[model samples]
Target: MLRTGASRLALRSIAGPAARPAAPSFTPPLQWTSRLSSMASRRPQLPPMRQLTPIQGAVLRRAMVGKIDRKAEDRYQHEKLEPHPELVTTTSSVRSAFSEVATPEAPKDVDMMARVKYDFTTIKDTFDLSAVPRQAYLIGLAGVLPYLATSISTVYCAWEINHSVAGYGYFLSAQTAEQLLHFLEPLQVGYGAVILSFLGAIHWGLEFAGYGGNHGYKRYAIGVVAPAVAWPTILMPVEYALITQFMAFTVLYYVDTRAATRGWTPSWYGIYRFVLTFIVGASIVLSLVGRGEVADHIKGIPGAVDRMKNLKDDAQQALSHQEEGIGAQKAADAAKED
Candidate 1:
């Protein structure tokens, strides 16, 4: 009986939930199966294949070769169209480019000449002188204003010259000084007169150019004034005189003479044509006749600029002589000291 009971107990124990190999550990297998199912569902996908045929590759390669050959031929046709070294860079071409890069660029003379031509054209466009549209009173005032001022200034300058000459003549105790003074006084008077008259002429010329709507005249005027303003501060000793005369002549040449030569119509030439004609004709006449009569003829002429160049030349020569004399005196003094 006991054996029978023991065998039954042993059988029950082996079949029990805790003693039957724990149902062969089924949770692990189930967990593994679930994990495998999830991994299969999450797998990556691949793209479809692009099947390029052998014939297609051959065609593409041939096209590329044809393009490169065409490009080479084009480069040959244009001398400057050298092959790109990286793309088709030739050793000689690279060396040439490098050498050129090292060399300095040539000066642009053509550009400078073109600029001068443009400036010349601009200067020729401004010239007009008519006061008819202005009130008669204003016109008369403008005309007489400069003249009155000029005359007054001239008379004052002449009086000063005469006084100086008379004083020198008295001091000299002879009439020789008076005779020399007479000639010299007139020369001084002539210079002042010319300077004043030129002031008016220059003013009139510029006014005409401005009214005539010539942009070139404006540039010429600007050039004239520029010199006048620059000389006051510039370091050069000759700048004062040279700049003044340059300003005057430059304005006259570019604004008045050039425009006149171009056949521009004036509202009124007035006596200007006859005046200029006479002055020019007289200069020729004096030059041809004799030096003794030159002064006599110049007294009758209207324009002042015709004689200015000669006067400036004379003044510059005098200045040079004075400087030379000073230098010689200094040298003589140094020798005496030695």
Candidate 2:
């Protein structure tokens, strides 16, 4: 009994715990089971694909094969056309076409003689002298008279000195010749400086008048410097002063010409200035020559008077010789007649 009991205990220990039977699950309804069975039996059917006709299939295939990006198409077109870039007519072509029409033909014959012989009156007319005001002419003539007077006085002084005359019975006298020249030299120098200053001041006036704009500074500088330069020339010798003045006048005329060319002055201003400059330059040269001639005569150098005496004596001798020759010719003719 004890052994059977021990064997039963060992069997129980080896078996550990006895399995309990699972509680009976509740059965679904007959309709539910039939629905689940039908669902299980029926395989899910996919949506039918859209049917394509032969033409449609061909279009689809072509669309897929021939799919072109717009940007790529444009790039391809540009590349394809780039090699033939000269297809379009350029502006050069158009210009060349019109160049022939615009070009003038050369003359078959040229009349150079006729061109040379062209009337000078036409050029004179172009200057429009009539356009110059009466006041301007009067003022200009009045201004020139002083220069003329000085030149005449210079010539007279030279003449009187050469002839050893004491006086001209008018303005010039041998006693006053040196004094007169000294006075005239300073007078000319002062007048030239004044005129140069006046010329420079004109640019200042123009500047103030609003015509100069940003260029007024340059004009102002020139105006100030020109007068300053002219004033120093007066301290030089009389001949040098005159030469300096002459050079200043030339520079002023050049400036005036450039201004006139650029339309800074009146249209007739250039011609007017030219005329005045010519007169002034001539007077200066005359004064210088007269001074030289007078100096030579004062030094007792052979001069105009001596040359004149020689010429006169030669003329008288020639006339006497001619009369003698004529008398001899008459005598010869008489002898031949006999």
Q: Give candidate 1's error at residue 151 in angstroms.
A: 17
What is candidate 1's lDDT per residue for 145-242, written digit by digit as tens?
44334333333333333445424422342234334333433333333234334533454465566645555644355445534443332222221322
The model with the greatest TM-score is 2
TM, every model? 0.22, 0.49
Residue pairs in steric clash, candidate 1? 85-89, 122-216, 125-214, 126-214, 128-208
Model 2's TM-score against the true structure: 0.49
How well does candidate 1 score on lDDT at residue 302?
Answer: 20
How many angstroms is residue 255 displaced in model 1 relative to the true structure, after the best TM-score fit? 6.2
User: Model 1: C-alpha RMSD to truth?
Assistant: 28.0
Report the C-alpha lDDT of model 2 over 167-258, residue by residue, as the tens digit.
Answer: 54355566576556656656666677777787778778776776524465666786887798798876666677778888988988888778
Highest lDDT: give the candidate number. 2
lDDT of each: 0.41, 0.67
lDDT of 2 at 6: 38
